[model samples]
Target: MRIQKRTAVAVAVALIGSLTLIGAGTVTATAEETSVALPSASFRDIVVDGVHDRVFVSDPTGGSIVVTDYAGTVVQQITAEEGAAGLALSADSSTLYVALSTAGAIAEIDTATLTETHRYPTGSDTSPQNLAMAGGKLWFGYTVGSSGGIGSLDVASADPAATLVPSGRYWYYAPALASSPADPDVLVAGEEGVSPATLAVYDTATGGLQKRAERLFTSSPSISFLNDFAVTADGQNIVVAANNPYDHQIVRLSDLSSNGSYSSWQFPNAVAVATDGTVATGAVGDFVKTYRPGSTWPSLHEYGVNDLQRDGLAWAPDENRLFAITGFSYGSAPTLHVLPDAGKLDTTLDVQAPATSRKGKDLTVTGRLSAAEPFPAGTTVEVTRTDAEHPAGTPVGTFPVSTATGEFTFTERPRGTGDITYTATYKGDGLHTAATSQTTVTITK
Candidate 1:
């Protein structure tokens, strides 16, 4: 078997090069980047508690969990049992459940107090990997000997019993696991190893398997483990980050079929889907990029942070913020990044033309473009003309805006009488809404 591969940096450059053909109207949104260093270099998972305005990071090697504020400020560090790897937050965001691999137990932490409040033992030898909160219970994947499977603990029930889903010999202790936020009955799991990776969907309500798909990489030995995967808020799409060329695959949940695949600038270690249908990817070297589903081209929003060791990405809908965990790779220090939601731009278009002009005479059209933030100096604006003869309008021409004053001008000779409408439009960047302005001029014989 032959395997195809390309470096993420080269792909990003090619994507950027292609943008020039789409005209200068497209602009990349700028992000304010801030980082908070962690005491330990080794990090596993990260979760956000919107209700408490805090973020939690698991430091397995340090045997501690670091807590930070929404602004990426260190708040506190709470000690945990050894091998604290995966983390899950309760529905109300009041309690955080942690998987202590070495201790073979799940520990619960109080958000306000930042302390371990309770510990539930899974078993003496089971090593839990990833955790999810669904069906009013805590679902986790554990590896025992050569086999592993999914298990759940009904935290809501008075007894809170731990039970494993009945499945034949399967590798349930995969690196990627997620539960649908909209539907508690849906759960996604996958196996990451030298053998072909298998992705499966389970119906938690019936403990029945819904669907499974196999992903075989020709050169599997060279590929590392699958790191990040997310289920869309609507529970309709599953995004998985796979190695050996470092690409993201989107799968439709209804039929478990491939929807699309995307290339990244770096190995995407973490991925997340926003409530509003935005997909964010955090890769090695702190390269973060976002895209709209089903689009062939990448969006203009990208963020870069120095010495960012990619780990996990989490979205906080209530606060409109993205929290990214960086560290545990490339000999870089562990840090947390806080990126605020993209900002909106206010745009205005002004058109100037003679009130009346003679037929066959030059009709000079001028316009100025302004926005909340300064746009690229020579960005292009499209112009169109409509007259009584051709009310539908026809392309006049495309002129580049003046870098000095954000103004554009075009001269056209009239050939017909009656009113002529000249319109100037700025087809907005993905981050900002587009704007249009027009002015009418009367031509008499």
Candidate 2:
């Protein structure tokens, strides 16, 4: 009952105040955020349909799916289902599958028409909460009274039905599921509502489910209480967000080994991976951060918000923008924030120079610019020199990087004595984030 109220004025003030706060590190990019008030107070999941240019948000409490355009304007609201929660879109973005928790079914909505054409009943009182599509099947996490399990609905079947997976009975609540386009046959699930959560990776190739690996976070106290997690685009790793952890962790999907993490504020509760392998992680601390694939360093972009709800993050198929659902406070209408240009690749810049160089002598400054995506041809890095004389820094030269190796080198004569700092900055282009690295050298007689 309380979830039906709206506080547009208070929500608007919170959005404006959040804009003035820096969400992450020094290199965080500024994102223009546009928020649209929603009809629901409680939300479960978000999915973006790039083909139809629609964003769907499911509200379990309201028992409906709120559909919006790329601009966050509500185009339609489908209330044919009860307790609508998680959402998954077909590869072609033609069909949207909704998990009807109270109705115990998966509703299929024709994206173009914005109508529910069919509802495949999972069973009586299954209470499906989260959904993912992989191996040509719609996988769902469901609860039956006190127990929870995972099941799949073969959407392509003539008479589609939900078949329970026996390997999914290890949770008190329905787990969160994730899959990757790169490895469509691989599915990953993390137990929800359970501290010291257990994560299981499944091999669903050929439409068969088999457990490949699993890990219980009991060994690491920081990893308890799973909030949200995602399988990387490459399907080689799983990025996890936990309540006790101050960072989102990247772990191998094979053995669940430690890989890397995207460090951020505490209470990381939501995460999503873009088609381009860019990872967007959100925390209730009111920040959403994006990291390039496989990089544990600082994020490429971080945007501030009121508060990112659990399972609140989704990226458009084109990776052009990100759609986030916020506003979990009581008596507030949920706000959909559209973040433009939020999927840029991250780059690393390293500048190396001789430890000592003779005054007025030639010194070579060399380094490399590395990124998951290749740099454009003829990419150049701007180099600067800073010392006691040029405290503000002086332009040394613009050096070109070997596109093949991302390495760049330039020669500069040391005119200023004492410790001279050579700073190499890659101004970055549309595809990559700007990176800067510095190395110091002493100038001697």
The candidate that achieves the highest TM-score relative to the unseen native structure: 2
Q: In model 2, how large is the Cα lDDT of residue 287?
A: 69
In candidate 1, what are the lDDT values of residues 75-107, reduced to their tens digit?
A: 898885578888999988889999887887888
Q: Which stretches of candidate 1 lie over 4 Å from their true place?
A: 1-31, 172-175, 207-224, 293-296, 306-311, 342-445
List per-prediction Cα lDDT, in the order shown.
0.69, 0.79
Best by lDDT: 2
User: Residue 36 lDDT in model 1?
Assistant: 75
- What does the lDDT read for residue 423 in candidate 1? 75
Task: State the number of backbone clashes in model 1.
Answer: 1
Expressed as tens digits, the lDDT of each residue in 188-229 for candidate 2 is 888876777888888887676788998888764348888889
> What clash pairs does model 1 have?
309-327
